[model samples]
Target chain A: MIRRSVAVAAAKLTGGLSRRLGFGGGTALPGLVAERIDPEIVSDMAAQLGRGSVLVTGTNGKTTTARLLRGILRSSGLSPVANSAGSNMMRGIAAALAESATWTGDIRQRDRRIGVFEVDEATLPQAVSALRPRAIVFTNLFRDQLDRYGEVEYVGGIWRETIDGLDAKVTVILNADDPSLAALGRRAGLRTLFFGLEDESLAIEKLEHAADARWCSICGRELSYSAIYYGHLGHWRCEGCDTSRPGVEVGITSIETFPEALSLTVSLPNDQTAQFKLPLSGLYNAYNALAAAAAASALGATNHDIERGLRHASATFGRQERLTIEGRDVEVILAKNPAGLNEVLRTITNNGRSENIVFFLNDDIADGRDISWIWDVDFELLSGSLKNVTVSGIRAWDMALRLKYAGFDTFDRVELDTERALRKALTETPEGEPLIVVPTYTAMLDVREMLARWAGKKAFWQED
Target chain B: MAKKLRVAHLYPKLMNIYGDRGNILCLKRRCEERGLDFELDELSVGEKLKSDHYDLIFIGGAQDVDQRRVAGDLREVKGDALREAVENGVVVLAVCGGYQLMGRYYRTAEGAELPGVGLLDMWTIHPGEADKRFIGNIVVEWNGGTLVGFENHGGRTYLGDGARPLGKVVYGFGNNGEDAGEGAARAGVFGTYLHGSLLPKNPKFADHVIQAALSRRYEGIELDEIDDRVEEAAHAAAVQLAMGRSII
Candidate 1:
């Protein structure tokens, strides 16, 4: 107990010093310090939550889904603790718990506290062994950070191992539209609930070029899809083994995508229907909303609570975030993988067209050193839509080459410096026109910091 | 009149884990820019290769499961036709897993030997999971110039007397860390682990491939050069990055 108290105080002091020194958002540092002091810090703090915890993980939609679930839990009169700034590793979870705890290592509102965390794919196993949460929610999986995760199959293999080791009482929340994820849930023999989109009007005839999960997990044959919403997700079945997508307990019956919001009607598991307007847009967020709703239902939240939670949900930082910079309307969308980028392009092109856009690509460890995935992204979707396009970041020339091959005759400018590129893109945009900014993971952080400073807002860590 | 080239992409749906389709896009754009009528055919599982139909063939990387499945299909259905094409000087390019499957065999870390197409006199062995994979930005010296791309592979390959190395590694591990060798080449067939699509940045190498394909129909044909300023810049930047220097 004394060691835990000392660890908490040291972590809080380190985080305060980190923020005062302008080091970063102090998201992962405090957790690092706390772990060095107390190796069991995460497990120790997570145990104090009376309602246990729920883990959300996948390649994409983790942050958004966790944020929405936190809101829903809170709307249900429960206090939820989350890593809200998108720092999603074990250390980030530690920092979030540390920040919420008192110096004496006691959680505030101990009886009502529920740990809500969005963990990285590779870190999920360690997190599960530590937190031992009551429920695990998996969003769709795509080929992301190949250098780090090896491949999608490798991730799935680890997840299967993790699920097999879990207690039978733990509920597994899955996305039914993803064949591999659904298969994982089916084979786990644990309590499982599925959520998916049932709207055919939003389906595409063919799978996108970057779809990753097409093979059947049970039979190893190519799975055929009747309708592909995006990537390899949709109503799919294996011709070889005759295994198909599981029945969805919580499904979206209809969806309406607007420029700034998504209006969706969800059919809950209790035979109750809820209509809510999510302030976030795109079909990806719609999936996140569905996953959150299903997980909330498993956590004993009511339909009214789910509806109100989703209705009041807002965008996480750097994810469909809208800002007015220098009197120019700018929207920052974080895209790191081929499937994610394709969805972003589809959403932007489908709703409203932007004349000026800036693309940032970085090869930092967080962004995956292999930038070849850019070729897999169907940038041809925006072939002739833009009047001015600026490319920047560490691999600006590579992006420029990609655009050239995509039939863009020329670029407005290719700037390696992100700040300069963002400034130039904003200046080139005509008044009253929106400027779209697409950046990788690390590039998004840099751009977000600059934008926050310009907007006279506090740093992300200081926001809440 | 425009000259025509037929390219066959092998196992496009199954073996395309990396950005392998980018190589096809690069080839098509380069051919179209130079007034060559480009035709592409995708050959997946259970698909056979037609004799005298294609001038060039491409196969990309895949995971272990997909690679094992493709190995069976390749040896059973398309082995003889592919060997005949190679003997006839048809240009072939295979990256990563494709490169492993074209060799004699691949010994997995678990002691199982998966047979290859035997197109090259090379074999690969995965030294178990305890060993580190050769993965990073790579720079190589090939054809009197520098070739820069990214390589990620767990199997370490060694070439035999039947094949010559494609290049000497200048930086990063290639083929195997014990050897300075990168890839293998013989009779118009080239195999490597480099998968920065391996063509977009290396325009000179791309031209070499194009020239080799065009030579099949038109002997001593000289190809016109499109502006490659962006391609060259990207290549140099990658090389600089591999050399541990800042690229700006």
Candidate 2:
């Protein structure tokens, strides 16, 4: 325990040094420290706390769920040791653990009640093996990192294999709407909790083929969907296996969409339900909240605490996080894939206001140099109410052209000069309306930096 | 009325990444500049590939699973339609997984092997899954012309004995084979793993394919000139970066 604490502290020092040197790299320094010392230093530090651990992993919604779970745990009056900086890797987790550990290489027992860590999907199997988290929350899996992970089914198979190897005591919370994830719950001896949206009103009439899970995992039959919430995730069933979305233990009933304030009704594990209002938008966020709630219930959090956390929690960076600058409101939403962007488009259109939107696309190394994914995004979801959209970033024109091809009017289309685009988009926004800025990975970082500078808040992610 | 070059984009609805449609646009713009007519026939499944009507046939790459799904349908294609077209001097270009599918067979380590359309004798073999993700500009020397683009594929391809090499490998595993850089027949079909919509980075290669298609119709015909602004500083930077040469 003492050695583990020392290693975490050292990792923290490494992260601090990297930040002090203005190096934005996330895993390089703490990786070195973890390598030199105990390789499982991060997990060991968390284990030393005597508190159970819950890990959340997925392509999207991981960051949002992590933030929600942290708030709920804090509201429950438990000193929760979490990766507050949004760092999910071994070194990042070590740095996070180092922040809470005492100098004597021991977690302060009084300060440690539970730990929640959001892990990268690619690294989940390794981290879960070492951490042996008490519960794991999976939001949904999509076709992300095609160059690295191949396809979504390939990732689904890996997740199943990883979960199968876990100890029988571990609980798994899954999104029942996802065919790939919900199928995992069918296996025996696995303690699984299913959470999803039962609200049929949020479903789209037609399924978008950009990257959807249209086939059933069990029977190899094509899934028949009554409606689609996002790509492939909705009320679906397989005729061959007779498998479908089971009765949701926890469900997102209603989402009251408000500017900077959204509310939802969640069915708690205790049979009683709680209505919580959040300052976030879109149905995807409702799923994020349900995942956090399900994991919190697994962690023994009370309904009251979950309610408070949902209402009191501020938005994390880029997940419908609202930033105010010069009396204009900018809703910074991260749209990495087609499903995410489609949801953003739906949420903005649901507002029924003609507002200027800033769409940022960066074909950076992390953003998948193949920007062809833009063709799959349902930009057609934006109807006549949507005002001019200012495209910006590396592939801004590419995005604009995609929108144009989708039958969107190009009259309001503007080239994406990042600085000028942001300024012009924000300034052109009519008063009393929110401006939506959709950005991919690197573009999200750039917009987050811009917001952080204006809002006078330091970026809390673990990168450096 | 001058006849427009009839082009059929085969298998576009699938196996297109890196915005492969950008290639179609590049071709369209080039043709428009030279006052040459261009009509695109998007022939997906259930659509026939009429060899006599079209001048150029272009196919893009698909994922391994999609490749398997499309393989059976592609085998049903009238080989004579394509082979005859090629025999009579029709232009054909396939990129990435499309290039692999045009060959004999693509075998994966998972024990799954799908038969290729036999447009090319070469075959692709997946030797234990590996992520050969090579980003940024890629340069390849081919037939006195330099082809540059980006490549990200898992399977390595081996060239058949009768095939001619595309170019010398500047970087990455060229075609995944020991000797050949890519699969290219100087006078006929052109196949490579390069993508950034291949032609945008090097218009000369696209032009070669177009000229070959037009030569059969209009002997000694002079196509209109295209002024590619990208051939300026931006492209020079990309070329420098693709080569081992530093821009700084």
Docking class of 2: incorrect
Model 1 segments more than 4 A misplaced: A315-320, A410-412, B245-248
Best by DockQ: 1
All candidates: DockQ = 0.72, 0.20
lDDT of 2 by residue, B1-248 (tens): 86578788876656564446666766776686688888998876545677777778887877666566567667776455776777777788888877888788988758688877777778888776654443444667776756766676667787767677778776545687466476555467888887765765566777887888778777776666655443332344345555643243
Best by the lDDT measure: 1
Docking class of 1: medium
Per-candidate Cα lDDT values, in order, are: 0.88, 0.72
Estimate the TM-score for candidate 1.
0.98
